[model samples]
Target chain A: MPLMTSLHSEASSMEFPALQAVSTEVERATVDRARAGDQQALADIYDWYMPRVYRYAVARVGNTHEAEDLTEEVFLKLLSAICDFKWRDVPFSSWVFRIAHNCIVTHYRRTAQRGGPTSEIPLDMIDGRHDIAYAIEEQITMEEVRVAAAQLPEAQREVIALRFAVGLSIAETAKALGKREGNVKALQHKAVAKLQKMLIPVDGK
Target chain B: MTEFEQRLSECLEALVQGRLSVDECLEMHPQHADALRPHLIAATAFARTADQQPSAEWATTARQRFLIASGKSLQEAMDIEPEPTFFASARVRFLLAAQKLRQERSTAKPRRVPLFGTPMRAVGALAASVALFVGFSGYTVQSADAALPGDWRYPIKLQTERVRLAVALSADQKRDVQFDIAEERLQEIEALAYKGKIIGPGVLNRFVEQTQPLVEQANDGNLDAGDAARLQQVSIRGTQVLDQVEPQVAAGAETELAQAKVISDTGVTVTRELVVKNPDRPNIVITPQIPVSTATPEPTEAIPTDEPGAETPTPEPTDVPATEDPEATPTEITPGEVPTDSVVMSELPIVEIDDIKLHTLTAGRLTLRAPGPSTGWYLDGVPESGVPLLVTMKTQNQQSFIVLNTQNGDMYWYVSAASNNRFDEIQMRLTRDGQVFQADAAVLRYFYGDAAEIPLLVMNSIRILPEASPTPEPTATLESEPTPPL
Candidate 1:
């Protein structure tokens, strides 16, 4: 219910890169074709937001497979919902992510009902690419980021994950979370202030 | 937002995108520089975490599933709109997934499903072929390449790949070709993961073994950008991949995990060694990587590991350890031998991952071999087909076979689980983790080759005793044949 507060938030000082994101002329045409049952156009939409959707889902869900399943459910749900979606001032990207965020939240609730989700980072399928080994550093950083993120208060975590993990513009994140742009900014600043302690290099070396 | 705060937000966004330097950021807002620096640092790190790419397998599946479910309702996972939404302009009804469309119609009534953009007849023909695949096994091979694993032709598909390798001209050509094939293997794993199909450890093991040497080889030469980019993509992606794969390995593979680390640790040294001497070798192109040291620091040893994940400020490696021969064979040396070379320059701790091979098999394969004991060997009951599987297992007594169907990107879970015999320690280990075997271990070795060519594969036993030899070809002769049917 909190996420569905869908009326557009008032404008604020921070400019939303709304044009650069969801409402581009090409995107509008693609939406048009998608509504007309052009599968390719719908596929294009999947291509554009999949990585972002996945990043958000994975960070939120903490498992690739679960994240993937949730993402698929979100898209499938979108198929029925898309026709009814009249573009407000909000970006289409935000609407989809809102759906995805709800999907993940519902998943956690259901899994939690069954017992808490597995605490162990399910090390089930190993992917040891040579270059991926070099990315070991990035992976370690991400894991730490993941843990640190999980530790944040709910609102702060939402802002951080939406803005950073999903690569959303400030306004898009605000739209997706159903919050004012200024409120999103304030939450982001607080979240960063907290993470700074966690991420700072010791001894300043 | 005040003008200062507005500029501050822009600077922070730029910092997160890695476009603005911390000093330049501070310069823009001299008054708020100190207050904002720490937040900028946090934002930058979050940005880095966001930069991680989802596994290619996940990406491919997301697109296909969307295509497959074009106008479907999530409830029944169908596209047959009992009630269609009205469109203001000309509406074009694209054809649907036949399966979903079929389900939508009342089961009591049978009717022909019409095609829209693409012809329905062609798809119908393909469906008929798939149906035929189940009826006759051999008919599947010709169309096997397009088959996904679990399809009837998957075994022939695996055999087809083996046949291709058998005819390769030279060892160098074979290795190069194998590297290319390994990428295909990775794509396959991604494809399987995309479909939510079961990917066993064996399949991933094959790819891991294939790529280990390739990863090692990459460090010896100055990497071109394309190659470096490829390697980086694999390495970064491997993190999430490890999350998917590690639970499947039987415990004995702990030893295998260490070997993979040697390659990564060695890579770190070569990359560092080059950078340390960059003033001399300026022309050799390099990936702009700030190597993150994953090594445990010791008081007496190299303490200046990159320390990327933990920000504990260990001093940079100022001393270089004596060089151990980089060429020393991985297994020949003491297992998990920490590289001592950082003492020679700077004290960089040797950060080695325990087993990258075991991990990569999430996207690779498992190979089985036995040189001693029962020279006539079998995996999952099928007679061993390929030559000692070109892996560096400690001994021939224990082997892991990760059979993958070449036509399809699916893993042969049967082959992998077969190695999990009652006596097998690996099985015990897998059981210790939460992996439960879904199908029978007997399925592991049942070969589905040409009915004439398919050996009466011995079931469940890894070793084929001489008395029970199904096919009496020498190991050399077997080298020329394809992997026992996928």
Candidate 2:
């Protein structure tokens, strides 16, 4: 019951507008300059993509510290490989997120080898802008969702993180994950269904 | 997909794009209202939580590091050579042409036969050769014009200049070509240095090698007035450019830079003497203006040892232990308020273990102080020299680790409250002798916001002891055990 009440309150307060991709012409010119080793142009690319990349990283790893480390690694790899990037049907955002995906996969692999905890959303990581009561409620709701999503299959988790958390379109998510569009849709549906079942009972007991 | 599933997907997309609210989505799909409501709420909450922006301090530091990496990557990419096949094919073509010409000349008799047998044929051959030359030569020369030392077209540029020199009928013309080539090398050095690329020794060596002869020629009074003026201009410009670029040159090229500077200075001296000898010559002005530099000044190599707004107080060594007095209290300082005047040690009771004190441990030039035995902190490993001295302490509720740079007195510490407390290994590996572990230091300041004062105070208490004479190793002698050992 508390979960339902908190969810209703959060729904009224938060907005879920779609995140727009940057203009193609400006991005293409910037990428061209970046490939030529222009520092300002490379900085521009980092400024535009760093946040979205961080969001996807945090959504996947569920830890701020790990997410920050992953973001740094992703950009370092980008610096080394940007010269070889060729424009194709895939957008630069897709290419960048692909790098993030690979980094997260590698991170998880290393953690598993060390037998460490896979995902943990710390309760103390709540933003301090809101009133105490509201912040606590929001933190609880957010933690529940993160915990539920982490229990989903890895592929399904990646689909929702890219599509919902990062605001990537289904097509872009497909390209980032190197999957078919139809497959991405299917995964998204199953993931949402599982999350709904876990967070809210279907029989309304 | 089932109809219900298809309807659910549509509602989710609509909600995400803000085209419909959750209630509106429920209204549109009345049958799937119960299923869609929770899903929409969960998706929104996930996005809200995941959309975390990095702290402003972290972002600023990360951006600086990223730019530095970009400079290094650009240097590396430019250093890579082109494919070997291109060079091999070019070499084969040159060799085959030379061999064919030699064979034709050796086998020819002294007959009066036209080379192409007819005027029309000769004209056609001439046109074909000209067409071939114009097709590739124009672009190659244009592209090679701006080629830097490590660039693939650099060889072509050098070869073209050599050909120009070979065709010059007069020594003055050849000398003029040499001056142009030397000036071009100077331009290349300035351009590469401005871009923050590593200027290899070969580049500076080439500049010195080419310009030294010109400087000697002018000094020996073997030049005309025009050539002397040109040499003066080139030498003056070289000195100005080299001085501007000295800071931007990457590490490990200092010897070559010094050699180049020496040649430029000699040229300037010789050229000035020539000018003094002939003051009546018109337009032989010695004061050439230095070009305005457009490069961003590189970051300085000095590491800031003192905190901002804090007085640089030299800590005095004390003979009394920190816990000797009952009223000795630990003072609380805030982050960036690192005490530099005196040793602020913890008042906890020091425990002596095995004739060695556990609270204070000395290694090389650094002396570290931990809280006490009750704090459940202990040294993790034997401290070593020539590397970062890692003192790791893990308690039940919190974990803290400090790395001391044995070379410098810089200290990097981290404290984490999470159960899985782990320091960044990559950052730890970046701790070299002379360089500051800037990223880790920034992280420490960010994470330890209010509570940074105590750890910093304890860390700042690490005194940089003076160097002492090495003690001679005691000789070891084998003692034979009794017959029981046999």
Candidate 3:
């Protein structure tokens, strides 16, 4: 109750700003507007971080529809809790990213339980033209990279998303994730190492 | 920095900057990136998915919810752009959820009460789909130059390689197939959890065995579900194990992995580990050393009773010699009291009576026509009203009045004859305490009474002052009507 009461008090004090300042300011504003019952404020908040959220979702779920819905739900969740949001402890984006990650993880668990396809056909498999230049310059190789990433161990893939897609600083991601910064950094190291090994050519070798 | 860290940083920076495209990202760290880039690419792919604007129907459906939360219909809300703030968005999200709940209420018939200790079921895939299509306009794919045809060949080649790698008839290929099968099994366990199926260690072991192959194949670049499924089917003959496992498997793997991470860690432990053990109760041997104590009953005394019916004949009286015994019972009167029958009420003298009608002089403070009624009225118990047989009760200390209105219900309290100095103090006191003053109009019949009690005035304000408080009486005696004046 104290946490909730204190959070509510802080939420009331921090209101949304119309024009953007720094990303931090934008985040504060989003939280404030969400607390104030502005549904559109939620949409705007989603719009700001959705690209990253969507990227993370797709990385884990490997489906556009699922990723999009998951991303939306994450924002919706954040919006719902806006009234009692706090800025003292953790970075807001990290928290939101954590939600997105959790949903993807849940999706994976569900589909695996159902014995659905685990080796997902890359999103490009579902639809072509992910990037026009890739299609023009080198479709075959880029497609291989996409499939290869999917083939990586789930842990490695997670590290990639936390590091690359979410752009979380090691410490922020670690805290958001309840992990040691060292462990997260190690994961990033291994994940990127694995990804690089799997996708590059060894012409000299 | 170590070579790996340095290369990883350069590669990641390039990846984040878009300077190193997916192919380039893969080129830099082929075996690693090829296995991992799919995730980032998948993310990119979903981000690029075409955005479907919410349909009018969806907005209409959400309108009622908006109305309830914001006092604005969905159409109205949508027509106006939302202000940029988290609180607003949160409200919108709640409004949306509320709308969904309302729609569900309208269309669905409720059934199946929740049971205690049961886990919550995941949202149905169909329900999830509806939420997506209705709330968000489906996945939006971007059409940037980086995601076009030039990059199409790589993924196709990868898929083709996977197909070959999965079905390769070699021993290594079979091993790869087994790993794929293992991965499929793990996925099945995951799917089970997702579908809300209960599982145990046996199922978990099977899941691990099934997923092991996939992990191996994943490492070997022999990954592709279609090929894996085909090979698994050919080997197992319609086991449909993969089909049964993948959905929940995906969900399960993520959960199990997350839970495992939460439970334990190598150096730089990731999360706090919690272990719950249900140990068996220990056996105990006991010897009876002392007797158990019992309670003793209490003693009771009883009086003798006799049944009377037939009387016996009297015995003859024999006179023994008259002797003065000191023990003889004495028949002497004790000193101070007189017998109750000797007192007489008939000796009292008669009192004079007068007849005149008196109106209520003031509220709380009652006055009667002095020259008319000699009868004293007792209020509760004490003589108060001037008219004979008048009574007033003080329920609360607040000065309440027994206002006696005339038969026609006129305000008799204001009568000039009833107005005087004695009444003024009573009114002032009653005003201080908030009590309703009323006089029983029926008491007017008592106007003719003896001069001993001329115009009896009852101070309903008896308890109004701290001094006139009634002696505490038994609660049982309080309800009875006071004895009528003789």
Candidate 4:
């Protein structure tokens, strides 16, 4: 039988080109040295997590400018605390993700306080399938998916962003969201189920 | 978990990966096909959305920021230097303001005496015009600082504030400025709410849209410990503002009131997290901002008992948990809002959930029914699988196994490497730490690769709870009697 890792996550086959796992021996060595004050290694760590953090934050915030600012703040925070960051078995990406998650909640809270609109995923943020070969029905279907996802609870929305937007593993997602792996599974199931109900077109055309 | 549920989850995952046709999954799992079909389709559509990647220029800029900050910290540590005034953030602003003052003074031209017979009349007239100009400029600029939706000059205010942000030297300064501006917007929202304007939600929407990013920036790591307390103050101000909002703008509208309530509630939570990270004050309760007080309160209002702008000496880094700000402290909970312990939102939300899920994870057991002479059997733990188990049968055969992870309806397996009779029963795993997948049941089916025709299915519902793994007694997972490998 094929290895379970390959079949279980399909991380290698996912369409998101940027979801490269940082499990290489080189990454571990860099993290170790960065903790020890190696400047170049620290830069590498920033480069590695920046795209992931930005995509995840941007997806939740729904504004590019806001996401960029938040992403910058997250990196700077990482800069200040990198030396103090302890490396347990958890991947450093998960730690960065936790920061992103906190930032999103805090962002939402602040907006709510100011009496603001809740974030709905912005259409401009999603790339439309440009290949003319794809049909109109597919575009309509994709739009429905976005609207459906926008209505989910905060926890469920997070699961969708991490899984579809940033493409983290179940274990990594659990670490990032601070949920149990089983809990992530349950959330993933619930969110998809809701999206399914919402996205399906009424019986016939 | 029903078999259909498991298959549906697996098929959904596959559909998300673009690996399986939705029709195929629906056709194969007819029991839940209709229910699963739409979900799979949606998942497929969503998965096809291209993932975002930051522009390379952004990547370079962010990289440089990290390098600059990291390098500065390293140099400071190596030199054993006191805190360096690393950036001229304040001095630069002061210098710019001074230069503006000098330019204004030098540009002032002497006005010719007007046709009035008396010098006093001419002077008074000139003074009135000058005063009018100054007042207009001052009022306009000051209003820009507190501009909110519905104000005639709100756009001007937003544009001027944008100019201020463009000049900000550090993320911390930007965050502070953003918080200040957001506080103004909150005041405007509350004021409009008090007036019972039908336009209240629109204004509130603008306030939230603008302030949320700022709040995120404030909470993000750029702030010093002192600034964390400042952020808490911002949230408290928001809570007070929401109290105003509920009675007026959201009055008689249950949905609007509920939204206002959540906004205020979240503000308190953010405050608690910051307080826990940076406990600057001693024996102080994080009192909510009274509504009237929030109308014009400063965003950086220190603890109520303390002087404004007073910096609590940042404690030594050693005394602070690496997770928290060295300057902010958890203030005591007020007399009635919430017990201090309940407000301890803690570092992780999942920690609270984990405490409850383990009750369902009964202790899993492994039993060997049939014994063979000179056969060594062992079970081990691997890190890769969240619920990983390495099972080995050291008989003269190459063996692999598959486990049906009933919790999510996925199946996976691994082949143990050949080993001599070194370990009779090594530590095995029912589940991984930080990985609370369902704990109750799994069926391990063993296959003799190149040794047997049909696979041997050992179906046992594993009732495993989380184990301490401390005592030297028999492994918590081993059954009392060995079940045969029939």
| Clash tally, candidates in order | 54, 0, 139, 25
The weakest ten consecutive residues by lDDT in model 3 chain B span B267-276
Where is model 2 more than 4 Å wrong at Cα?
A: A9-13, A17-20, A203-205, B18-20, B27-31, B80-486
- For each prediction in turn, the share of the native Cα contacts (below 8 Å between chains A and B) that it retains comes to 0.31, 0.47, 0.02, 0.32
Candidate numbers, best TM-score first, in rank order: 2, 1, 4, 3
Supply the DockQ value of model 2: 0.18
lDDT string for model 3 (A121-165, tens) is: 243343243476544333344344456667777666776666665
What is the lDDT, from 0 to 100, of the residue B226 in candidate 4? 64
Consecutive 10-residue window with the lowest summed lDDT within model 4 chain B: B354-363
Query: Candidate 4's error at B162, in angstroms?
Result: 18
Query: What TM-score does chain B alone reach in each candidate, compared with the true chain B?
Result: 0.24, 0.34, 0.18, 0.30
Model 4 segments beyond 4 Å from truth?
A1-18, A118-143, A202-205, B11-35, B48-50, B55-60, B73-486
Q: lDDT per residue, candidate 3, B367-442, as tens digits?
A: 2211112222212343233322233322232222233321111121111112221111112112212233323211
Per DockQ, the best of the predicted structures is 2
Badly placed stretches (over 4 Å) of model 1 are: A1-23, A118-137, A201-205, B1-7, B15-24, B71-486
TM-score of every prediction relative to native: 0.38, 0.41, 0.32, 0.38
Query: DockQ values for all predictions?
Result: 0.13, 0.18, 0.04, 0.12
Ranking by DockQ: 2, 1, 4, 3
In order, the Cα lDDT scores of the candidates are: 0.47, 0.63, 0.39, 0.48
Accuracy of chain B in candidate 3 (TM-score): 0.18
